[model samples]
Target: MSVSNPTLITFVIYIAAMVLIGFMAYRSTNNLSDYILGGRSLGSVVTALSAGASDMSGWLLMGLPGAIYMSGLSESWIAIGLIIGAYLNWLFVAGRLRVQTEHNGDALTLPDYFSSRFEDKSGLLRIISAVVILVFFTIYCASGIVAGARLFESTFGMSYETALWAGAAATIAYTFVGGFLAVSWTDTVQATLMIFALLLTPIIVLLATGGVDTTFLAIEAQDPSNFDMLKNTTFIGIISLMGWGLGYFGQPHILARFMAADSVKSIANARRISMTWMILCLGGTVAVGFFGIAYFSANPDLAGPVTENHERVFIELAKILFNPWIAGVLLSAILAAVMSTLSCQLLVCSSALTEDFYKTFLRKTASQVELVWVGRAMVLLVALVAIALASNPENRVLGLVSYAWAGFGAAFGPVVLISVIWKDMTRNGALAGILVGAITVIVWKHFEVLGLYEIIPGFIFASLAIYIVSKLGAPTAGMLSRFAAAEADFRLNK
Candidate 1:
């Protein structure tokens, strides 16, 4: 596990390059809008890749692969669920949200969009949504931190404490400096690195294991049940895994990419590009885990780290299967995944604080430069909190992510979906949906109710709450008119 000079140098170059991108983005960010949403000027390719990269996170390389390596094909259900969910999010929500957010007073954050969309004079929607974002995203950012720490800790044999801070520093540095554009631009680069690594690693592993037949043979020989997707999973377990797709409707980081697109028309091409990349990356992720079983079965000695921590499956495979120089680049993809997601999560949290709270309440007349600096400061602040939360060495990246993912999915998914499409949805209904959805997730997760994923109950209840409440109270005339206008714009562009 000793780190080679080539690997260390590669790591340094990659980190430095990301910081350089951040500095480049800093120049583009003269105002609060540019700082938070890239001035709504990202092209289709950048938008697609950045959205994909931010959505996948370290979970694609580390968490999902590890799960599949440990338990076989049953773990692929989450990937399947995610693909379905992401596509639906793009089809149903992406273009519409781009138009709706712009129509709703050019909102820069989800909380701001909700406030404008519903005309919430009391600021209740903005406050609650922002609080939900800060709470869940802090935990979400912590997952990225833990994944990064694991990478540095495994790659360089650094102590967990040192690795934790080291892993977080580069992401925080760039995000603190470059703001949204830095994160988005680096996300494109990171996304490219991620796909190359995911696609390359599995192919190499398959070849090393003597090809597809031999790989499957070895997998079957190691454990016959490894071939069965349904072997260990129950009906509810399968359903719970599939429910992950439902979370896509509500992820702020992913939705922000849609909002930042140069035009609503661009979203069609972006959706196509994003989904293609997602499918390829996810397929490779599963292949690495599935093929790793074969590779490790033939070389049990090198399987030690993977056995100790299943999430290290990709890391160990990359180090063992490639030369130090090639391995360094591949390993950097893990960092890329971590940084891409972490940077966006940090930016989203910063926007929530800076736009939704600070400017909205404390400084309504704050200058663009001042707000941009405040946004950077908030990035640092949130990174500090996430680092503190990730101080524990035992936190699993997937576990932390699932909890936070369900929180956002349940709390905002129904409200977001219904609001953009349903003109009858009242502000009260949106409020009820948020409360019910978020509370259901928290309570369900706490009680481990029915062993079902909290998002299932949360999404269902939130949808029901929105429908029932809206039925009881009608939208104002202005709300109806705004919805009609936004819908017209969406249809025209679509």
Candidate 2:
């Protein structure tokens, strides 16, 4: 039973709700901070969902399913790496980052906080960091846009090019008006819906097609490699694959949530919620893809072009179990993953330009209102650039993400980790780590493949670069004591 009238209604209703939620979020936003960080007042639930939802995005919708559909349960290892990594980041980085950023001042963007944190009074660090962000995030947002286009083109009959434009326009509409508040609140809603879709679709598939044992038997019969975790998978492949987990560290969009949280105490609760959501949703997605092969194998028509095009597993399962109406409602979850992440990326990119660069240098006297418009202009600029890259229709979503994700993970993750804890970490080390991380990811991607994952390799080298550079060229010796005293002072005052 392919998608029927009921499925169409569900899809329309789901899309409409996303737009409506964005509008509702717009009402709560009064200023840049409100627009960007929900007034720094988001509780644990919102923070956790937004963070998880934004983090998973195209990787979950297109990449994960494709992996499972092609590789089998061995793909589940990636989920393990990601969930564990996310939990640790929340536990270690989120609380400290939130407290330190707010305590230093109310600067909203990541580069703003970085510049201020390291006392880069010349504004050079902030500007440079902002530039790196723009360069990488543009590619990141492009991947999400590509995923969005794929969802529409595959699930619907829409052309990929048209879908790209429409998706961008729709995401831009909600994002431009709603800002970060709208993105986060709407993401919470979308994330909930995404979990619903991930949990339900595969469960129905398993029940309909006998059970887990039967599904496994079917997959193994088709190809023994289906059960092989390491089949065609290399050390670099595994590392590069799992290394994706490392991306959580330097991610400006996700990290900014930590910066704006209501309090450090919330990180504990948010961590629990976020890790649980990631495991469940990601685990379910992998299941859906693996089960799909067994499912469609019993009914050959469901199988399409091979080559691990399992990206359509969710859509295929939806059409199989439910009416077209249910399928539509369910399919929007992928859209949620794509758009939620894209919205967050676009906003952060714009903020980097308007807040970190423009305000930092060109117009010290620029009014808040003018800066806001500059951010708006930057949004358009980024949207145009990303869409242009996405129009090719041949861009592989996962490949693009792997490169950009590794770049950020290696570049920003280590420095961010050390910065909050190691007072002796010099600005020079921060700069070196970021450059090495970003450069390593790019060079390795184009020149040499890592043992397991691009991110893992990039992270190791980036970290080594920072550690060695710091050891060789030290920071102010007394700064560590002063930093500790300052943290205590802030706590006492509070």
Candidate 3:
């Protein structure tokens, strides 16, 4: 199939704008801190939108709608869980993390904070945390690539292999050139595009289906189960879905947003803005997926594409329900979702490599300019590795996302919560918690006999490990002192 001229132009313009932002950010970047965390100068709106954009990713646009299309309202439990989790993360972690990270030796990365907070003289905490980030983020970033490949394959009628590289190229170029500033600025734009597309598409879809009541009836006429919100929803299933929220505490990219905010006071405003955007976009996404069911029911023969690939519902509807120019803009929303998340992931990976491993261990005396370039180089390298992992056409974006989400949520979530709120948390406790949490997620995912999501068990065990180990290891005087100082500083800032 040949590509439409309007869509091609829109896409080119969008990509060009992103690259230009990168060049602009490159000019502003003077040191490693500016490259990695935007010099800790992000305002409320940028912080909120960037965090939301990076957190939602393609899973919001593709995996989510696809699931709702196939599984009905039951799939929405995940969204509900995430909403609660995100709120708590912002309320509890965001302000505290910003203040604490600055107070705790002005730590630049998550691993840096952990090592500094615990006074880990042996560097074991930093190495293990960085390794976990690298391992899980490789798989996490692959999900975003798969989503971009799916979009390119459908939108431009390209081969999956070609689409894979093309999908990653723009994200890599901008992230490699502009660093954190570039990623944050692009994410703010992408988040706006995503919400606009989601909001507009749902309204158009609902209107075309005659309205909510009529749409629900059309869906029920085909399959009554499609309208049932609790068809197969069990206690365990709901728990598992909601467990997605737990991953919020552990996500390196989201946490980076809080760490980069202009001040502690900015967090409250950012949280409110972010939550509002999240709820509205989530509602829109659910409506679009549900509307796909009705639209297909009204035209059975025309449903082949959606039936063949549920993830293509949004793309298919964009073309069918709107004019070429408008459809192109709508489709760019998918690209926005993909690029926003991928850039953030690559930046986080680069930071982990540069701040946690490269500067800390490999080159202790490296200059600011050298560190910035090294970070950029790692961004390109990490994106390539993720692209390779995403090469397989059989991978489902949601499945990959779920696995990685569980890995990060279970492994880091418990440790982060304890470290910030509990002064008695020891270095050994943090290490044990991370190792136990990460290992449990992997082991539980493989066995597949629990009839529960892996995060539930992984979180439980990880939290337990931290408490038990902390008591056994005994908190050192330095750890307690650092905790007190962090608390005092947080109070002053708040």
On lDDT, the leading prediction is 1
Best of the two (1, 2) by lDDT: 1
RMSD of 3: 1.0
List all candidate RMSDs to the true structure. 0.8, 2.4, 1.0
What does candidate 2 score on TM?
Answer: 0.94
Q: Report the number of clashing residue pairs per model.
A: 0, 15, 0
Q: Please, what are the lDDT tens digits per residue for candidate 2 over residues 1-494?
A: 22356765776676677777778877786666776677799888999999989888877867888878877877777887787678778866887787677755666987877776677778777877888898889999999998888777776668888779866777887888778888898889889989998999889899878898888888888887887888877775665566667789899889988877787667788888988898889878888888887888888865764334666677667766876667777888888888889999999998988888787778989876677678778888999999988888888888778777877888899988888777777777888888888888777777665345657767888888878887776666444554675466445532
The TM-score measured for candidate 1 stands at 0.99
Off by over 4 Å in 3: none
lDDT of 1 at 330: 98
lDDT of 1 by residue, 1-494 (tens): 48779999999999999999999998899999999999999999999999999999999999999999999999889999999999999999999999999988999999999999889999999999999999999999999999999999999999999999999999999999998999999999999999999999999999999999999999999999998999799999999999999999999999999999999889999999999999999999999999999999999999999999999999999999899999999999999999999999999999999999999999999999999999989999999999999999999999999999999999999999999989999999999999999999999999998899999999999999999999998888888888899899999878
Deviation from native of the Cα of residue 397 in model 1, angstroms: 0.4
lDDT score, candidate 2: 0.79
- Residue pairs with colliding backbones in model 1 are none
Residues 1-494, candidate 3: write the lDDT tens digits. 45679988888899999999999999999999999999999999999999999999898889999898887888988999999999999988898889788878888899999999888999999999999999999998999999999998888899999999989999999999999999999999999999999999988988899998988898788788976767788888889999999999999999999999999889999999999999999998988888888998898887887898898889889988998889889898999999998899999999999999999999999999999999999998999899999999999999999999999999899999888899888999999999999999999999975568998898899999999999997787877887788788777776
Output the better candidate (2/3) by TM-score: 3
